[model samples]
Target: MAAPFSAVPTPFRVRAADRWWYGNCAWDAFGICAALHVDGHIETVCADCREPIVVEVRDERPDDQRLLFHCLVPAARWWADIVFT
Candidate 1:
């Protein structure tokens, strides 16, 4: 259970550096690319509709504008119950 990377399958996935990496969440997906400092493609599904979603990241910035990241729990409390967060 890596922080930005997951040991098991998850909705968030990143394809970068010629390998596939599973991410724990949306933020982590991008973090994987940022940490590697390489362009990446992210694949996931919309939570509400289950529709496929893809995002591209270059130079640590996401290319898509139709994306949003929201967290109900504040960043300070994320680690308290990370499994639920």
Candidate 2:
């Protein structure tokens, strides 16, 4: 007889373009921290272009917009609108 079924794992999906898409900056950072499960400043590369990516969680001001947005080139800037907002 076949074995009883169990809860199956679903595929984790992330768009290839999102790494460069400015709107997904938060999502990208969130994913990185979640993936590494680390604390403090983190330095990594963009998943798409391999450019440097830096994130820091520390004693900081909440009003800082730099924490969310980035100055991307014209191509990426086109998709910079915050999707969740």
The top-ranked prediction according to TM-score is: 1
Residues 1-85, candidate 2: write the lDDT tens digits: 0111113221222222223212234444345334434333434566569776655533322223465444455544545653332
- Candidate 1, residue 51: Cα displacement in angstroms equals 0.9
Candidate 1 lDDT over 1-85, as tens digits, reads 8678899999998999999999999989998998788999999999999999989898777897777799999999999998788
Instruction: Kindly provide the TM-score of model 2 when superposed on the true structure, using C-alpha atoms.
Output: 0.27
Q: Give me the runs in candidate 1 sitting further than 4 Å from their true place.
A: none
What is the TM-score of each predicted model, taking all chains together?
A: 0.92, 0.27
For candidate 1, the per-residue lDDT at 12 reads: 93
Deviation from native of the Cα of residue 70 in model 1, angstroms: 0.5
Which 10-residue span in candidate 1 carries the lowest summed lDDT? 59-68
